[model samples]
Target: MLDLLKTPVLALQDFCVLCGRALRNIVRRPHYFDDIFLQMDIIGFGSLPIVILTGFFSGAVIGLQMTRALQTYGATGQIGPIVAVTLVRELGPVLSSLLIAGRNASGMASEIGSMKVTEQIDAMRALGTDPIQKLITPRVIATTVTLPMLTIIADFVGLVGGFIVAYYLLNLTAGQYWTPAYQILEWNDIAQGLLKPFVFALVISLVGCFYGIRTTGGTQGVGRATTQAVVVASVWIFILNLFITRIFVNV
Candidate 1:
């Protein structure tokens, strides 16, 4: 019982320490602008296609389902606002973050874990390079910047997908679909939508880097870290979303 309790506490402590170090590195001098840009391109561009598809399909499905449900009450017209709000304020960020956790977080952990197992990170330290500053910082910065942009794209694409379904399947006109959707959204809603992704970006990237830098053993360790990173990040996204949503609701 003691061992079980102690293990989680120690792991939490270690994670907090890693996060502190990464945060400190962000504002320090010698910022790796080139590396940051490289990571941005890799993360943003690499993840675009999947994000688009995920958003599109999610909105499409929501439209199909919600339209039918609303029709029961003869409120089918409200589908636009419902789908828009759901996609923009919730599903957009959540789904995109999940995808990024699976794709980028796993990749980061695997890559850094491989470096650790191969002793390349040690060589970097020996060569007077700070691995956190050089390797982890850039990825963190990139993810923080990229995720919100992706979420925006996802939200827009999702709305389009919703519009497509509403127009074709439900025979709703463009004005009937878009007007309520636009009117129902306020600055607060947009802020809430954008804010979650930024927080999620930090969570996913930092967690990935944390597992990665702590990798042990050999090739097997890399695989383990990669899997753990994705699972942990994905779970955190949902947990964080709930708290963030509550905050938004209360405010």
Candidate 2:
């Protein structure tokens, strides 16, 4: 029983060794640049519209909620600062990471799982090609690079959404929203928020790829990998978020 438990730990350690060799191969063969660029487009550019829409609606709702909550306290003008802090510090990164994990990570697992089912991974190894260099590294780079960019864009759009609705719909002046918004959000708050997505990106890719590589059986295996990838990756993202928040708050 102890050995059965340790088997997973041993397997994970072996995976890291494989990852190091993969990274080396990736560095040596520059042709994988094509895959990297292609993934960035798929992961980054393709995700922009959805992230923006989610950000806009979330921001608008937050503004509306904050306005109502503050009105009860007769401190309605504080809505801007509260909205800004929430958007910049918490909502923006967390929401964006969860969305990306769901969107990209599950798809990644399914795609790779299908390849495994088809014996393409074995074929690549037989042909003297490093599958990780060809496949996993590009995903890792693209997701890590793209998510922070997405987070920043989401922050800006979300804040804009809040500001527009607050100033126009709620009858708060433009100055009322923008000024207090500025005052409440420190640079470090933004930085700490931004720092989180990289960890999430890594978690998503690792979990997705881990399941992808382990995929077996048949159609059922592919389906299982896809579902597990999203579920596990999202849970990991939430857990990581808690730790990150604690670190940021404490330090």
Candidate 3:
């Protein structure tokens, strides 16, 4: 019973230690520009299709649901601001983060876990390479840079998707939808949209790397770490979203 309780606490401590090392390495010399760019291409451009699809469908669905809700209030014309604010301030960052967590976090865990299991990470250390600097830092940098860019794309695509629904499906004019949406937005809303994803990217990448580097038990452990990485990252995204939202609100 005591061991069970201690397990999570120890894991959290180790994870924090890994995060600290990664951050410190990021600031130090010998930046791996090639690896960073490679990871950026893999993490950012490779994930675009899914991000686009998720954003478009999510916005369309929200538009559909919000239309019904607003109809009850005879305020269907207000769907623009409603959808805009919801997507920009909340849904865009949260949903995109969750999707990236599921996709990229699991991939990172599996890749690193495979290296650990196959002793490739050990070989790197034997050859005077720091796995944390070479493997983890580039991924962290790529994820941090790409997630915000992806969130912006998602936000734009989401708005466009909502506009399609509002203009065509709901028979609302472009002016009716876009004017109010643009009018209702504040700088704070945009800040919240952009900022939350940066925090979430850190959460996803670090959690994935932590789980991956710690993985044991050979192949089965790699699979388990991959699953755990996704689950933990997704939960952190939601938890972080609440705190970030509150902070943005208070500010």
Of the candidates shown, which would achieve the greatest lDDT relative to the real structure?
1
Q: Is candidate 1 or candidate 2 better by TM-score?
A: 1
TM-score of each: 0.97, 0.92, 0.96
Model 2: runs farther than 4 Å from truth? 3-7, 18-28
Candidate 3 per-residue C-alpha lDDT over 185-214 given as tens digits, one digit per residue, 9 for 90 to 100: 999999999999999999999999999999
- Give the winner by TM-score: 1
What tens-digit string does per-residue lDDT give for candidate 2 at 154-243?
A: 888888889887888778898988898888888779887789988888788777877888899889999999999899989988888888
Model 3 backbone overlap count: 0
lDDT of 2 at 153: 88
Model 1 Cα lDDT, one tens digit per residue, 83-141: 88998899999999999999999999999999999999999999988999999999999
**Cα deviation of 242 in candidate 1 (Å)?**
0.7
Model 3 deviation from native, Cα RMSD in Å: 1.4
The alpha-carbon lDDT assigned to residue 186 of candidate 1 equals: 88
* Model 3 misplaced regions, further than 4 Å: none
Give the Cα-based TM-score of candidate 2 against the true structure.
0.92
Error of 2 at 28 (Å): 4.3
